[model samples]
Target: MAGIFIFSEDSALAKQLLTPALELKASLAQPITAITLSESDAEELAKLGADKVVVLTGGTWAEGFAEAIYSQISKAEGSILLVGGTLRGKHVAAYVAAKLNAGMTTDAKALKIANGKLLATRVLYAGLAVCEEEVALPAVATIRARTFLAPAPAPAAGVVETQSAEADSRITISEVIPTGDKGVDITAATKLVAVGRGFRRKEDLKLAEDLAGVLKAELACTRGIAEDEHWLPIERYIGISGQTVKPELYVAAGLSGQVQHMVGCRESKVIVAINTDERAPIFEAADYGIVGDMYEVLPLLTAALRK
Candidate 1:
């Protein structure tokens, strides 16, 4: 029992955090506890290796969410806490860490027990360099999505603990306006098609959409596509300032593969680049490449997939 508290609003994200939580547990010989507020099924978390599940039932905002989790932390259940690096996760972590005055870091990619201390690896200087730091105990961090793979479930039942506490709401939810088609969570996508500046115009996104359809992959875009052209929503943007994705198969089309954009997708299993510039940075990171215009390659690629 590494005494690590892993938290997330959704089960899927919670499960992803469990992988590292379980690792710390096994290495430190302590219990791995998971916390969630969502009504979604989280049994998989236990099966995947959470020794105890803390079912927090309360408010939706940070204040409510923090109080519930903080209550457990106050009990000294875990000195080390891990949360997803999503916008919400960052806030919750910041709130909890601030209240406890514990060491905190976000966008962490690696964590390990070093010299009897928790050493975390993180990117700095705009993803130009990696650095490691040892944090004090009772620390909290937000792990970037796709930074760690979901490990297999251990053969044990994680005990369910419903610990409730009074929560003060800080932010009120008036209405929820969902975006994207079918509410697809790109962070969980196994296959993705990323569009870039190669497209002549926003209307040309249909080609990428067509390819995504045949591949059954999520559609993602670089910062330019989303911010400048407004071809895609900000949520669909992939980069350092955007969402990070680690799909099994990532196809980059019309993208020069700038370092910023590549930071988000570098963890992908296999990357395929399609651009007219052979010397494009994306090709260097890709496993395969086609030095040609995306407009010409996308159609042929989609046609081939159907056969």
Candidate 2:
């Protein structure tokens, strides 16, 4: 029977994908099938709302199961497949799309079924524009983290099944060296303090860090701070090519809010900007603006929040 399928290597993101999958299920009247590498995730998905949970075991790496995942979906004649939008997940999703000869959408912000087609909304041109893509059935799409909240538990849990799948042996495992930088998942942060090029030096970041600490928020940065200056980890960067966030409070400090940067945090519930230049684009996007040096503003804000 044709059904809607969801897959993700990350357990949390897998659950998030269900939000859209459930919506599609409501519109298409198809059963929901969730595929995962973890048995624990299968149980969670089964409880959450998936009509069926297929646990793909025996794969050393999640990406290696792409072929197996495609096989299962093809055998089941799944009408639509939603994959988690992580780097690893994207790789698996693309491979499966190719094997199925299906159209795929990446970083899809929204999804829906209309007139027997899967319509996905996503940003285009370095976040300069928004466009909707309509794909024919047997469609595939990748959704980023925090794009949707996990659906509440279903009235009744779904069935769980297991399938043995071998990992691709083409690439052998070697040493796994950790990057050592322990950075939190900024996309999942409720509040964020994003720093940009406006800071004079890396040491100046301490000011922003102080503010974040007072607000109990995570530290985020523009691409330059992370990539160019190396003041922060790459994972902390927020831009068109970086992490997108929808925090309850977003404080952009010393950052010129270009489209590339704003695109990532524009959906924030409340945006506050502190830039010396009044003409900065960040002010236009922010819900509140303070025209002054972030160096000056951050200290004052932190002091006030601390009291």
Candidate 3:
């Protein structure tokens, strides 16, 4: 039988992929094979419901193992391959898809096997619309982080295998520099305080920061705040071209709700918008809204939460 496969260099994301992989396994009647670069992740995936764990060793660059990953799936007669939606993972997924001559989808919000075809749901047109794509097997798809929770431990651990992969030789690594202290992973944050261009001055961001502190939430921003104004790091920006987050509580202060920005956090469990303009588009998507200046509202809200 053709198998369902999963791959992710990021250990946490690899495990999370298993949740949907297991679901696919049930519907496709295929075994789940999880591909990883870490032994620890291999073991965890095996326990989480992977029928087989393939640990790719001897690879310094993850993207270098694209051909190897394709080979493994081809050998197993894999019908579907789900890859993590990280930047590196996208490169690997695209390479493998080309090698397999298979159709692929990126940032799929949901996946299912229907009529022996892979159906994926994702946002489109800079988050202005949603669409479903159906591709024939052997299909490939990329899922963003926090898309699904890791399933409970499996009833029985699956088999584990190790294989050696060759890193790409064309690229030579001379030096490795680290981007130190880039704050929290906002995509994984349970709560987020997002600010947009509504804030007049960079110093006024302290208001949002105070509110975030009281809520124990991470601070996020629109593209303008990060890319143009340089108020926050680019990593903190949430949009179609930026991080997509589904936090439990999303507080939007001083940001106009544009389809481009809302597309990233529209899936948030609860969205609270604080904007001076009652007609702002953000209110339409918000679970709650306050028609008042965020500068004035944030302080009162933060004080209330503190009290």
What TM-score do all the candidates reach, one by one? 0.79, 0.90, 0.89
Distance from true location, Cα of 125 in model 2, Å: 1.9
lDDT of each: 0.82, 0.91, 0.91
- What is the C-alpha lDDT profile of model 2 across 115-231, one tens digit per residue? 899999988987889999998999999998878999999999999999899778797777766662465678779999999999889999999999999999999999999999999
Clashing pairs in 1: 1-29, 1-30, 1-31, 48-153
Which stretches in model 2 have alpha-carbon errors above 4 Å?
Answer: 177-183, 300-307
lDDT of 1 by residue, 29-114 (tens): 77877887754545777778888887776666544677668768868657788988878888889988887788887777788877
Q: Give the clash count for model 1.
A: 4
Clash count for each candidate, listed in order shown:
4, 0, 0
* C-alpha RMSD of candidate 1: 3.6
Looking at candidate 3, the ten consecutive residues that score lowest on lDDT are 176-185
Instruction: Tell me the deviation in Å of residue 68 in model 2.
Output: 0.9
